[model samples]
Target chain A: MLRFIISLWASKLCLFLFKHTGRERDDRPGILALRLCPNFLDRVKKPPLVVAVTGTNGKTTISNLVSNILNLEGKKVAYNTWGANYKAGQARCLLDAVSIFNRPTKDAAVVEVDELLSYKTLPWIQPNYVIVTNICRDSIRRNAHQDLIFSRINQGVSKLPNATLILNADDPNSSFLGENNNKRFFAIADQHADVFETNVSDFPVCPKCGTVPVFNYRHYRAIGNFYCPNCGLKSKTGDFIGTKLDFDKREMLVKEKDGEFKYPLVSDTIFNAFNIMAIITLFRTIGYSPEVIAEHIKHIKLPENRVACEDLGKIKMYTFSAKGQNVSAASTVFEYLAKEPSKKELILLLDEHYGDDPNIETITWLYETDFEYLNNENIKKIIVAGQRYLDYKLRLRLAGIPVEKTVCVFDEQTIPDYVSTDGIESIYVLHDVTTVLRAKKIKDKIKEKITNQ
Target chain B: MKIEVLYPELSNLYGDYYNAKYLAMCIPDSQTVFTSNNDKPAFLSEKVDIICMGSMSERNQEFAIKHLMPYKDKIKELVDNGTFFLATGNSFEIFGDHIEDDGKKIECLGAIDFYSKRQMNDRRNCFFLGDFQTEKGEDIKIVGHKSQFSFSHGKATEKPFISVEGGFGINLDSKNEGVHYKNFFGTYILGPFIMLNPQFLKYLLRSMNLNDSLLYEEEINNAYADRLKRLQREGTEFLMGAE
Candidate 1:
């Protein structure tokens, strides 16, 4: 008990110092607390309503939406707004919610937990609601495979019998987490979008009958309405189903057990739509009216740096961050870029940034990614840059992209020189998540090139 | 030439399927057969020039072993006939004796006298650098990555695949990386090893009695040189797992 008190007080002092020193977001206090008290999360007092949002892709956006909506409703919500979703960051967020005496002061807490580390962090936090967005192939070196991630998350969620789970019914891997636990599933009604053909998917065989399930309506990468002919397993629109997506009007209709309610779609991307749906399902389960949630959601927008766009006089430049090692994320971005009607030139800054460093980056994700999408006639010049330019050139060649259309520049600085604006109305700059700052600088260079021309 | 890719839907982990793809590109007009878990493998009925299989999830590994169990005799016969077989990542475990996973013994095809033990929670991520002697009697450096949860153990080490120079082999203590008997090559290294190692790819092509000409030879060679120099740098950590 004395050790726990000492650890709490010391961690509180560190948090206080961090705030005073303008380093409040740093997770050092949490690391120190965990080192001092191995079970600090279990010992510390938690907020009344603790919610955990976990998945491979949209956990950050969903948690942010949930936190912002609650804050708009005049409820104090604590969440990790930064990229630190690990245990140390989660512990730090929880520590910030309580008093120095270890008493809760916030109305609620929305924590974004890493899927791989959720098994270790979730049991301690003991959230009231756990929302699994979706599971897909992540970094092979870290996550290994989706089954390992599913196993870890399922183990963690199973321990919380009292906590209700809000799941994405379209994802076969994460939909069936805990059988006996309370599960509320949400799925989007198919928009009849073209089913993306690729070499990547992780929707495993039916657990009961050991046969592949049949998808009545397939979305991108194994996300859709699926059923088994051999067994009784099928996807259900359990509590909430998102339908009638309108990217032009930025609106979507969500149907619940009571009635259908219209909600404002925060972003035009399908993944962002799912993120909004997950947030809506969460707040509605917590007794928030749809009108109130929709009104607050209208003001909530994605970060500017995530999908920044600039008007470069004649051509529009869309600079966005795509996850490097994640195959599904890159494939989704490629599919989106390919569907755009305007003639575009792609400046790919998507290589792993640490090639020059001591640690080597894996190129396996390249083969898994659908670089073939860049082969569209609308996409004119593909200026491949960075240390892995040769690798990208080889992959693009194998994807049947004409050699004349592809330009490989060994130096990243020379990429803008290789990019041609002729016969192109837009330039899409796809970068790795770690290379966002570098991408912004390259975007500026390209902007200069176009304006000066 | 016909190349049979076994269980591509399941064995397509870590992008190692590109090995077969790269080989097909190297050898033009080669018919590539992608056999899924639901369909019977093409190698069962036809005499494929090369049969390849990559890694997969543990659950799918069970399905693979089950699908190939009835043809264990055929596999043995093929091995004795000196048919070229390339099994990368954990797919190598499917042809082993059995897998000891968390005190449970999952039976494999038992074509070889080796057993793999799985570490469910621990993943061994490492950079592998080894030597592969070509059919021309020249030694070529093979560079690849290993992101696996299990390693095989047995007398197959006597017929070691690539003599380890830097990274670990069957296990931490063993210097032998994989099993090389006849024309069968099984390694835990993931990724497109053939794409990364041009000389090794050329050697592989030549051994299969095909022209050794490669696509993007200069670019791939440059990449191999750059990666080799980096992996051999002083203070470069090879083992990427916690003790």
Candidate 2:
């Protein structure tokens, strides 16, 4: 209780200092507050429609998709597209939209929950809808494998009275959670040929029976139509249909038992579409229309970090994906890589600064992706840079990349050493949220050189 | 070489099935089979020229050993003959005398020259770098990651894997190329390891003289070469000197 009083006093102090800190990029008060009260998520008032999103990848993309879909249904939504999902950060979000008096702002709160924290605090919020994009191998350093995280997510979502569970049908781990007697909704990529790779950490055999699964086809990472050869329960998602994947237009066409409609793909990945499918299903369950969803997608773009392509000599993209337990970010990474014939050489930088605890445990979803599938004739190399260079290197190595093929640059200044002034005319960069600005500086220098040319 | 793959419940960090497929692809039409978490049988079959193992939790290790007791003498015989087995993450540790968890000691097959201790801070990593050789005696390197915890500490007198902060590695991928063994290779490289590095498969085939019996498609061969070059040229990850 005394700690709460101190935290209350600190919260008031933070609110007061919110106006005083000018141009200070450091999250001092935030860090202090977060450290002081680890379970700060309990502080926020439970909103009407508290939706918790999680996975090894695609958490944020789905959050944006769901939030926008809700907005289209004429409900106000407040969320973080930048993957700001920690408790205090989420608190700041609630404080940002609502009045200083802690009143509700939008009709619903679509919160992007971190994979690790999803298990920790979802029960506190008692979310109306809990969407787990899919569980692949992520963050084994800190947590267990997919099944454990899946159980934790279910535990949190189940705590909410009549809370709906939305999952990916194609994912072996994610789909398994639906077996429970809960109000579960499942969505999947229409075709086995996926747009984005699933983030996989470990090879999963049937827990019930130890048998290697036969994958009819691999979508990404560990997600696909898999049936355990021994148990014969590998995968049963044959008729499980989803929206047709249209990468060019970035629109989702979903058909239900009653009717069929198109939901715009906020980004160009089937994995994101998978989450959007969950969003639409939840919205429809809570009484929403496809027309409103279309309207909402027109202006909804919280995943704004997704940038347009620029041709240097080769087409390189400068995008931001997730680090730590942010599977949504991983999904974004796979989406960009899976788009073409893996022609665009990727430079993925995972910065621990995105979250306070950048434990590699949450980032273990690196294995769930198909680095080889993306390794077409066009793909040159995957450069890992930033504070946590070794972490990314380790993830890529475990993904079956030969050590000789990967490059790591711990020093920020050395990044330019690899930049060809004019050969491959493109650079696809995925940066963490906190490191996005620093990444931009590097990009800006390159852009200026190209512009001058 | 007919490789025998072991999907131990402990070594399966990053889709150990990929590693199984990878090794099978490298061998002569090798048949990849699955073993349950607790299905360790002795004198099972002589057909397995090479063995590949997967990952498992600590309890699963106990489960495997609990069943493997009857097969201990056979397993020990195979190990002594260097019949060739590949185990990664916690699976290899189980082959040792024992694996310590939560201050409680769990009995292992006691094949290797050491014991494995599982700890949180000791993370081997998901990706790694490796240097090995091709069939034509060409120097090659591998990149992939997994956890390989538990050191031999002069037990088997095996060298280290390039070296990293937390022991050898607890994750699936190695920090260096190739899981070096006298034909008995074990690595933490995910995607089942072999599928990720098709070059390793190509090299293994030629090394085993299966190239004459196997149809090596130019498309697949060129694709592998191109990928290596592309990763080396444009990719941010590379072997030590290449970096």
Candidate 3:
């Protein structure tokens, strides 16, 4: 009750500021709503086709895709475009959905939920459709272990039987939710894709039965075919299965209701397929078509900057995905280099917040990936410069890495990704969870370095 | 190959057998023996390749001395001949000469230059940095967590055991993967080894000559790889303190 009252006051305080100064932001309306009612979401209007997408990866992308699909069909979508996924964030989103007189509206509210808070928000807004993006060991520093993560996700999904649950079939644990079949849909990737993750294996085995699960195919970040020999349960055909059109070409072939139907997608890679699949399937159930989805792609870009292009003298260069806890990005890096060898130096950064945490030990699993194991001898030197510089030095060192091919540059300023003055085509990796403004800052720096030089 | 993992209630302290499960995954055998000191097993001497000890079950003054009695002499002999053992949490110290938990002094097996105490959960949840050696004679750095009051002999140890830093490696569950003699190595690395690190599993499989164990190595490893590449990249930033 006290929390409710405090929340109420906070909300009013936010509203007063916005009303007086006309400086509206994401949090103010939510503060006002909390002031109106602590259980605002529970009492607020919920659309019939509401879908909540949550997980460690792919939440933002997935949320956008779903909203785009709905908008293509010319339906209203009340959402948080800022990726404000907390309870207050949702309240703020609801506030935006309301008119000046304040009435709940929208054909569907495609919501991205923070993984930790999904359970807390679920009861308040028991979504009619819930999509689990994928499950990897995320935030053990802030959350608990992997098993606990799985358990918590299970808890969240278990609460919504009346809702349609769409899961990532490629993810063993996440796909397992499909077996329950409380009207759930699953998305999977096909094996024929030229793209493949070089690294992804090395998650802890199931404590229930020690027998390691089998694998049919893997699509980076531990999202692929799997089942325990002892358990005798392998992931089967999910209601919504995804087969990548090409590993290199980033196109996804969507198969719904087993293999009875298939369709092509513009989004590339199984990871993106997951995001696209969630939106297409749920909006289709809510009533949208491929052509409707195709309409949105005309304006959308595949979460650019992950493989964004930048000018470096006469050479065509791009900053590849790195720095995040993304195996797919690393594997893609391997795929890029292997498909088209880069003799030029690749500049990678390891910031303290992203990779410096010694709690960041699982990074060693990179050794198992085809990248390090296959290309032990590759192009130019690997610049290892980060806060926990020695940790990267040791991780690379232990990979039986050729010391001559690697250079440890500890100070951030010393890292090559900082500048393109030398006309070097470089790949600067970035982690996923970051202030977008910081990414924009880095992007600006990259732009200035290349253009100014 | 069957691996025996004992949840030494007293010596199996802090349920260090989770670390044993980790080591067992690195071994070739499917059979594992897990017997806690609170419930000592009778068939402990029958060709058991690995024994995992947990730390103190309860926080008390005379924790180590009371818990490590059953396998005291046997653990020492196993270490001398190189039998693999995992002593995590407070279990690492029960094998030590003495452990001062709060105000009590308890004697232990004196295996490594280590001792422990019973603090709150401050030692309970913290990540550590270490290394594991493969048969190919390469050192593999490992990062796992521990929550106990034990400390290691040195800041670092042998191959397969890298020196760890910038973590919660204080007087608590010293991130030690114990000494490796012959086939015997010990440490506080908890949880499923084969599942967490495929290198350790690969080492165990190759050592045990079980190529069959690697049937799904590519796929399983690919899954981990996908996650790890990001982890390593992020780890670089994390260890770099970029965040």
Query: Each prediction's TM-score against the native?
Result: 0.96, 0.68, 0.64
Give the per-residue lDDT of model 3 (tens digit) for A145-256.
Answer: 3344455567777777687777766666666553353655665655644454333432334333434455666655456677766667666566666654553554556666
Error of 1 at A405 (Å): 3.1
lDDT of 1 by residue, A330-392 (tens): 888888888878899888887675336556777888888888887898988788787777777
Q: Which has the higher TM-score value, candidate number 1 or candidate number 2?
A: 1
- The DockQ of each candidate is 0.53, 0.10, 0.07
What does the lDDT read for residue B122 in candidate 2? 43
Which ranges of candidate 3 are over 4 A from the true structure? A1-38, A99-102, A178-181, A189-208, A247-252, A257-267, A304-307, A311-314, A319-345, A354-379, A417-426, A435-443, B1-243
Model 1: residue A403 alpha-carbon error in angstroms: 2.8
Give the per-residue Cα lDDT of candidate 2 at B111.
65
> Which one wins on DockQ?
1
The best-first sequence of candidates by lDDT reads 1, 2, 3
Best by lDDT: 1
lDDT of 2 by residue, B1-243 (tens): 455445443445555655565455445546656665445532386556666666665445555566676677778778777675766545656566776765977777766665556653343443354455543556555545454334333244344332332213422243332234455455444434554455666565554456632223442344344334433443333222100
* Model 3, TM vs. native: 0.64
Pitting candidate 1 against candidate 2, the one with the higher DockQ is: 1
Cα TM-score of candidate 2: 0.68
